[model samples]
Target: MATILSIIPYHFYPPVGGGALRCYNILKEMARDHTVYVVTSQPEDTFTSDEDYTLPERVVIISISKMLLHISGSSACKKVFNAISYRVKKRTLKGPANSFFLASYSAIISLLKDVKFDVIYYESLESVGELSGPIRRFSISFTHIYDAHNVDSILWAQQAKALQNERLMNYANNALQLEKKLFKCIDTFFCCSYEDREKLIRLNELKISGIVVPNGVDISKKPYDDDAFKYSRKNIIFCGSLNYQPNIEGLLWFYTAVLPALKSAIPGLVLTVVGQNASYDHYKALMEDESVNFVGTVPDVNPYYYSASVAIVPLLSGSGTRLKILEAMSLGNPLVTTTVGAEGIRYEDGKHLLIADKPQAFVEQILTLLTDKQKFDTIRQNAQKLVMEIYDWQVIGKSISTQIPVLLKEKYGGR
Candidate 1:
């Protein structure tokens, strides 16, 4: 058995988003035969209750609070850092800023004074940047694993180009420079896809050890009836957190470009939106339209996925694999996503799901899903088959459990 430590920036129990979902599932699996410690965000921010979530036997939740910066450094310095976090949250809506996130090497190190962990899984940019200074101080040796949720530099550069902001470009440059330093401290990087792994290697111009661990759905969590799709309504479903900038950007783009034509053609067509809401003020017309219904933050998303005729992912820009795609596919909902939306996942267009980039093409794809019963059934079966064979969390988790120990043994000579 091994001792593993995971420090993610958000609350992961009963995970709401992709990152949180990945963290929760991975740690649960890791705790099977190992001692797994999680230091994640306070539940007051990401989630409120643990009524439904059952803890794994060997999994331990170490700490849950805001230690964003080096809280143990100095009183005045901590206040300054907290103030900067406040300003950033207030000024911009982009990025994950629900509250002061959970991240601090000093705080974590202090708690784990004498104990030595065999593996260190660092999950956010805040956590990654702090490891270089702290890991050197500890005499114990361990394999530091960096969980690359997305390529930070690329995502930041995309934001800069999209918004035409020089400040964002500077931030992107700083991110890349920080990664160059981070490369030295981290022994292995767990990327969501081989595509992301390739991009990271090309950017740093270094041959680094990395593994592809894709986002997955917990297939056996609840029983899903795939036959429900045959009797479901012709309505479309689009699910994602509105707090995220990319989801908002994608939805608004679709609403402005394709909704009118789709609504005109289907007459009674409705787009049901699910997930947490934070940014929808700019798109008032969407809320006012009778053809669109926004169902924000449901206790259960499986019913929504089961009831809809087809699920649509209209993302214009983002990185990493999307959990929504896997979730929809796992529950027998055929998908239509843009090329940007379909990144990272090894999805074959027209087989697992339909892909379209242009506005008219996207609309046509949705129309086809609604009209063509044979094509929809074929895609649905293929997608569900793909999920059962590859994207199910149980299967992926077992693979992760097997790989981590082997990597640690290979590096440290069977400690």
Candidate 2:
């Protein structure tokens, strides 16, 4: 077994969305045979939660070193120190010189002082953040594997364009430049989808080899009651992180364009927004809607997934394939997602899941599932069959377990 350091900006467990889930599952897979040491952080006080998350049995965990809080004076003095040191954090592009990220970088450097890892696995762009330039030297001895959860450059650029802010546009440019430098330091570039791989190669003009490690579902969890839809109510479920801009954008669109019409057509139609707690201020409309239920951050999403007559993803932003689509389909929700949501994943539009872009089209599909049991069951079964074929984490993780060891041996002479 090899010793590996899994580095990321956020805590992967109790994952609220695809990025965190990707980090957790991949590191869990690596820990099956490798001695994986995870270095991750919880978000600041505002977004922090008490939700319990159990890590895989064999992995070791390290919270980000709060060296910033180690000032030798009074509490007020420490505040003054942080204000003096990182007063510019809000002005800099996100992930560049953030306190936690800087501290995590410090922890990694401290680890490297005494620990020579066989592989240094960075989980996402947020994981690499602005530390790529400094970490470049360590790449000489360590097998640097970058698991890009998404092409964040494109996402940031889209955000920039949508907001039409000059400052955001500058930030987007910085993200592109950062990615360019980051790719140069990596040994293997792992893309969640072929689309992302194509975008990364074309946009960054990377010479490094890119591998597709598609997002997967844990099909091992007793096969979520495929027949649950038969008893479920007139419920529509949207399960994802509300804090993510894309999901928030999608929900806003759904509420504005589709939900009103859907409710009129199908009486008692309920939309339950699951996953992280959505702020009333951020999601004012979604919060106040009479037909919506906000079930924030459950220990297990299977109940919400199973109780819904249909699952929906109306994503208008973000890059990479959506794990929500795969997860809902795996649990047999008979999903209705936009083309953007289904990007780079293999599935038939009508047979495996419903693909809708416009308000009318989305309503039609939801109605089809809500009213017609046979159609719902057919799509449900087809989705489960598809998930079993390719999206199972057991299969995906095992592939990593087998291939990564070979790569390590070839590159650095295995332990």
Candidate 3:
């Protein structure tokens, strides 16, 4: 078995977002056959002494609390200032505000001592700088694997364009430069989509290509319940963290442009927005509307998935494969989504799910799916089957683990 060290930038257990879920699932999968060590960060206040998460006994989790420039559980004003200051200092410092994060690396390195890891799996490009220095100093020979949740540069640039924020724009530009400079250090790149892999290849002009490891759902953890499917289901579910800009942007667009038309077609239809940290302050009208119900954060999202007739993904801009789609599909719900929403996943329009970019098309697709039972059933079945065959965490985890030996062979001529 291989000894793997994974470095993540967030408190990964009890995954609260898509990125966290992906990291946790990947670690869980790797722990099945490998001695996996997780080095992650958390705010000092929220750091827990008790290990509450469900994981294999073989997996060792280590947290670096209150690391450099890392803040959590802070007030809104504090958060805003911290964000701005971090960005400003990042530019002034000519590098990431990762000094404290890098310092935590020493603790991790000291803990490992003489033990040599066969591979290093670093999550997100943001951690590359903090990890690179320590890994180089600690080990002479080890394969480096970069798991790209999204093309950071591209995603940042898109967000900057959307928000028109100068700091974000500068940050985006800086990320682009950093990615180019660090391209040579990565031995293997695990991207969530072909689009991202292609972008990396074109940007860096690298001879080696990335492996597409799409976002997946843990079906075993939350298995599909056939009884949850209702013949008279009038609920249209939209699941995503409300605090995320991309999700909020998509929700605003759907609420204004598409929801009215869809409501006109099916008067009884009620849209249920489910997920954590969804602020209804800007969406006061939606909150008051009887047809729209905002279920702000739930411990179990499976019930929402199980009860809905169709799930809508109205994403305008984001990168990487969406776990929302996989979750909805795995629960046997038909989906109507925008082109941006369906990116990276091997989804066929009108087959696995309906894709619509414009307001009229999006509304029409939802209406058609709700009216046509045969089409809805076929699409839902296709989606569930597709996920079962391809996007299951076990399948994805195995695919990732199997690559270690091959990458090892190429690097050292033996596993």
Q: Output the number of the TM-score-best candidate.
A: 3
lDDT of each: 0.77, 0.76, 0.80
TM match of model 3 to true structure: 0.89
Q: Which lDDT tens digits does candidate 1 get at residues 1-415?
A: 8898887766677776777788878877778768887776644344444765656878766544645333434577765665565445335434432232324444566656766788888887657665533554564587888888888888888878877899989878978886666667677788898888888777656756778999888777533446734524758999888767688778988998988888887878889988886555755777777788877789888888776788999999989999999888887888999988989888899999999898899889988888888888889889888888898877888888888889888887887
The number of residue pairs in model 2 that clash at the backbone is 0
Residue-wise C-alpha lDDT for candidate 3, range 92-195, written one tens digit per residue: 44443354454365656675586678888888676775566556666658888888888888888887888888898887888888677566666778989999
TM-score (C-alpha) between model 1 and the true structure? 0.87
lDDT of the structure predicted as candidate 2: 0.76
Error of 2 at 134 (Å): 3.7
Where in model 1 is the C-alpha error above 4 Å? 43-51, 64-106, 164-170, 228-232
Residue 343: error of model 2 in Å?
A: 1.1
Q: For candidate 3, list the clashing residue pairs, or say none.
A: none
**Where's the lowest-lDDT run of ten residues in candidate 3?**
89-98
Please write out the lDDT profile of model 2 over residues 133-209, one tens digit for every residue: 45655446777888887887778888777767788788778778867766576777788889888877776666666
Lowest lDDT 10-mer window, candidate 1?
93-102
Order of candidate numbers by TM-score, starting with the best: 3, 1, 2
Residue 336 of model 1: what lDDT?
Answer: 93
Q: What's the ranking of the predictions by lDDT, best on top?
A: 3, 1, 2
Candidate with best lDDT: 3
